[model samples]
Target chain A: MTLLAQYALTGVVTGCFLILATIGFSLTRQVEGFLNIAHAEMLGVSAFITWGLNAVAGWPFLPSAAVAVVATAFLGLAIGRVVYDPMRRLGPAVLLITSVGVAYVMAGVMHAIIGTGIRSLDMPLATSYKAFGLRITDYQMVVVALAAATGISLALFLNRTKTGLAIRAMSSNPELAASRGIDVRQTSRATWLIASGLAGLAGVMLALIATLSTDIAFNQILQILAVAILAGLGSLYSVIAAGLIVGIAMDMSVYWIPAGYRPLIAFLVVILALLVRPQGLSGKARS
Target chain B: MNLVQLFLAVVMFGSLFSVLTLSLNLQYARGGMINFGTVAYFAAGAYAYAIVTQEPPSGLDQYLVGLHGPWWAGFLAAGVASMAFAVLTGWPTLRLRGEYLALTTFAFAEMLHSLLVNERRIGNGTVGLANVERPDPGSLGLPDAWAYAGAAFLLMLATALVFRRLLASPYGRAIDAVRDDETAAEAIGKDIARLRFEVFVISAVPIGFAGALYAMITTLVSPDLFTAEVTFFVWIALVLGGERTILGAVLGTMALVGFQELVRAFPFESVRAAEIAAAGEDIVTGILFILILRWQPFEAMVKRRAAA
Candidate 1:
């Protein structure tokens, strides 16, 4: 039972990381109507920036993270303006492949520049407290807390803010939103910034628990993609639930399957979800 | 490497990937099936060949099935095995539409890749199957590389001819109809699902052969060799050359492989220059993919078949 409790706690932390990654991915897909594989690359850039400032330059963590987050938000904006905006005229297939190209470019550049070494921040190890016969670390608690804050805040922002409503409107029907005098270009630009900014924060949080590597960032694309697909691609609220399910399943699968096959959990969930409910848990049935 | 060796490398990769690109053309360009799990089929073939042709595991390396067969047998098994895999995965997943199908396939590929890495019994735990048999071009008194390159080129030519023939047949027209409008094709009493499944299975055959040929050329098989990068490389080539025509597949492979070779051949001495060249290739390909789609430069390349 304690083992079960421990695995569940670990699963929540993993799910939190995924929620941060997939929410942005889901939002971008809602607007662009294609799978942007390059969204994962944003995490790589922000993680690298945080590593550079906190580890290399000896700056403190919070300030360095703030700068990295802001920098990556701009990077997202620039990538939106430069790559996605112009490419929007093309069909989704073209955009999908282009996003893949962008992903490869970012990874290749990182490989050439950083040489595939594992880099991590110099944060102190957190003390663990035993409760209910399961040990939980302070860092784990902090991760869950931060993730909850981000998710709730984002939910509020989308519900309350004009930009958020506009984003929601565009997501439902771009042509309809445009017909109603919603500024498609400006909404899209704002969507890109917000999505990429979320991606930046996710990257930092992931780096805190795991080491920073370009491959790690790239590999997470599959898991995030799985979460997005299982959540029906664009439904933000459903994505949070999907992320937790996937994360927990991935961690708990080790009890039955070998630990090395944890990825198989995500794969199975995605394939099964796609097969049974292509519309997803929250998606409306398309005619 | 000398210029001759470099030239041979280009020809080898070009022909090998030409086979892959053509397979993709049949699936996507002709049949309208978006299969993102291509590398899975490719790797399946390579592993099948490796299992059949390799010597028994020695020292630290332990893997399943070392049948130790002739080169032709291994190659045939590669194609058949990949076809079987496609049939298994395609039957259920083919019901999905557009992005859903693509993501499911992508998930399947990633799952297989992980399995290959973790299951040492199947793939030898990332060390991979090595010392697989290679046909001796030495029997003909020609260089080994020349033999490999010549074999790949012949395979490409044969596959391309077969694809061209298929495209010219009523079967080809049926698929084009399905791709253009599935409901209309169904209205005309064509079995859309079965046709798609057949195309999907048939397309896997060449890719499987390409994977075996890749193993034969490199004389090794590893999970790293069959990454998503290989799939995208084929995609970039097909999209760049134009999708509907056979000429596009060949030309795209040549153009893409040629561009990479050009960058490699240039004497960029600085440390950063090499990195820039590497990253620039992807950036250029990305931009080109976007531009070609946005502008539809070769829209007329797709021949209309009496409105199907």
Candidate 2:
């Protein structure tokens, strides 16, 4: 029973990281009207930036993570302004395919720079805390706390801010949002920054909790897609439920099946969810 | 590498992968479905071919099944296996539209890949199945490389001709009608879902055959070789060729393959240099993909010719 609880605790941490990773991707789908395939590479970008600043440049962890997040936000903004802005009129399919190109470029650049190897930060090793035979690491706790913080902050931002409302309006209907005094360009740009920044934050969590590799970001996309799809693509609040569901399902399955199937479990749960509820946990579907 | 060898390599791989690009064309252009899980079918075919022709498991072999059949029988099984897998995956997911469909298919493919990697009984786990059997071209008094290249070319030609013929027929018109406008097509008595499911299944057969040919050329089957990368590569080719034309699709595959071959042929001084070159290849391919998509020169060319 304790083992199961431990697994569930770990699953919650995994779920938190997944939420951080997927919120940006879901946001991009909502506002930009396309699935940005390159979005996960932004995680790779931020993770590596943090690694480079902390390990290679001998900086402390918090400052390195902060700089990495900010830099990643700006990088995403530039990519949006340069590559995606002109192609906004080309329809979602074209933009989706083009983002694959962007991913290839980003991944290639990382491979050239980092080469191939598993890397870790220069920070202290994770301190494990135990209660009632359940164990959790400091980094894992940070991930959970940060996920809650980001989730609450994002919810507040979306509901309470002027720009946030504009983003929401633009996502639901672009032409109407534009005609109703929303700055289409600014909203789009803001989505990119926030989405990419979120990805950066997730990348930091990933680095803290796991090893880093150039190809690690690619692997995250599968789970992120699973959560996003299970959340019904555009809905934000439902991502919380969907992420925890997928994460717990994947981790808990290890008790019964081999650990190698963890990733497979996430997809299985998603495929089953999709089959039963095509619009996902949310009752709305993206048209 | 020698220029002639490079050309043969390109022709060989280009034709083999063109089979994938052609099927993707049919699915995306005519069927209006974005199948992001194409590698699954290809992997299915390859694994089927490998298992069927492989000798029954002996010492050190962990896989559960090996039919010990002839190459021809295995090749046929490959097609059947691919189509079967497609039916299984497509039946449930086809009702979902657009990116949803894409994601489902992709999820299914990843699931398959994970299974293959984890289940040693499937293909000896990550070690995969090696020493796959193939018919000998030397027995027919032909060079092995040239024979496989010719076979790939013939397969590609057959796929292209059949698709062209299909698209020219009334059935093709119905498929197009569905893509152009679903409601109007349904209003005119077309079974939209059935058409899409059929197209999805039909296009899968050629990919399976291509996968068998790919296994024969390489004489190996592994989870690593069949990844999402192959799916992306085919999509890039489909986009590069302007989506709807057979000739354009073939040309795009050939050009892309030729470019990759050239990059690989260049000599490098060190592992780092080779790594950088490979990365450079990716960057250049990505840049080309972006440029082609941004300008859409191929689409423009087709339009100009139509106007003329």
Candidate 3:
């Protein structure tokens, strides 16, 4: 019983991490109106920058993470303006395929720079706290706290600011938003930075909890896609719910099944969600 | 990695992958479906062949079934298996459109991969099935590489001819009509769903045959070899050749495979050098993909030739 409870706790942490990773992807799909396949590679970029600074170059973790996130945000904006802007004349399908090329290029650069090996941030060991036979680590707690903080702040930003209103308007209908005097270029740029910066933040949380290899970020794309789909591809609030549902389902399944089948849980969730509720938990038609 | 060896390798792999690109071309360009899980069908075929032709389980074998059948029977089974998988996946997914279809197919493929890796009763899990039986090409007084290359070419040519014939018919026009405008096709009494399902199943057969040929060429079937990377490579090839033409599909696959072969041909002194070269190849291939898509040089060429 305690084991199940413990698994659930870990699942929530996993769920929180997924939320961070997927928000950026969902944001891109909403505003830019295309799935960015390179979004996962952005996580790799930020994680590696953090790793390079803290582990390889002997900087403290906080400063390294801040720099990595900021750099990743700006980099994503640049790629957007340069690679994706002109291609807007093309449809979403073409843009999706183009992002795969972007992913390949970004992954190659990271591979050339980082090489193949396990890496981690040069930080203190995780301090585990146990109560009532349940355990949580400092880093895991950080992930959960950051997820909540980001979720709240993002909600406030979206609801309370003029730019946030512009973003929302643009995502729902880009032409309508433009005709209403929203700056198309500025909103698009904001979307890229925020989305990419969120990915960067997720990368930091990833470095905190898990051992990193060059391929680790790439490995998460499927799981991230699963979460995104369950959130109805472009919906925001449901990402939290979908993330936890998948994360807990995956972790808790390990109690009854072989550990090797854990990844299968995400896939099963995706298939079922897509089949049963194509519009997903958001219950709103994106089209 | 001599020039002769490189040429043969490109022809062999280019054709095998061309089978996949050709099928994708049918699904995407004509049927208006984006089936991103092409590797799963290919894997289904390979595994079916491996299981059918391998001898019954012996010492240390964890897999549950092996038919000990002949190569021809196994080849037939490969095609049937691929069609079966396509039916299973396509029936549920044909209702979805665009990126949703793409992601569902991708999820299905990953699910199958996990099953193959974790289910020890299926091809001994990650260890995979080796020493898969095949008829010796030497019986025909030909070297193995040359015989296999010829076999791949024959398979590719057959696929192209069949698809070309299918598309040129009235039914093919119906399929095109559906893609060009779904509502108009429906208005004309064309069953959009049925045409899609049929094309989805029919195109899968050649890929299964290609998978069987691939297993014969490599003499092995492993979870490692059938990854999303295979799917991505086929998509890139389709893009390179431009869509909606059999000849373009072939040429594009040949060009992409030849490019990779050229990079691999160079000898290296250290592992680092080799790794860097591989990375460089990825970078260049990606750049080329982006550039080609941006300029659409192949599409432009096709249009110009048509006008002239």
By DockQ, who's the top model here?
Answer: 2
The models' CA-based lDDT, in order, is 0.85, 0.93, 0.92
- RMSD in angstroms, candidate 3? 0.9
- List the pairs of residues colliding in candidate 3: none
Model 3: runs farther than 4 Å from truth?
Answer: none
- Comparing chain B with the reference, what is the TM-score for each candidate? 0.93, 0.99, 0.99
Ranking by DockQ: 2, 3, 1
lDDT digits (tens) for residues B1-308 of candidate 1: 57897788788888888998999999998888788888999999999888888877767876866888988899999999899889889987998877778888888888888899889998696888887787888989999889888988999999999999998999999999999998999999999999999999998999899889988887889888888777788888888888778878888898889778877888888867776677677667766766676566676445343344
Worst 10 residues of 3 chain B by lDDT: B287-296
**Tens digit of per-residue lDDT, candidate 1, span A17-102:** 89888999999998867888999998988888888889989999898888888888889899888877787867677788778867
Q: What are the fnat scores of the candidates, in the order listed?
A: 0.46, 0.71, 0.61
Candidate 3 lDDT over B1-308, as tens digits, reads 78889999999999999999999999999889998899999999999999999999999999999999999999999999999999999999898899999989999999999999999998999999999998899999999999999999999999999999999999999999999999999999999999999999999999999999999999999999999989989989999999889999999999999999999999999999888888888888888888878788988998999999
Error of 2 at A272 (Å): 0.7
Quality class of the docking in candidate 3, CAPRI style:
medium
Candidate 2, residue B102: lDDT: 91
For model 3, chain A alone compared with the true chain A gives a TM-score of 0.99
lDDT of 3: 0.92
Structure candidate 2, residue pairs in collision:
none
For all predicted structures, in order, the TM-scores are: 0.95, 0.99, 0.99
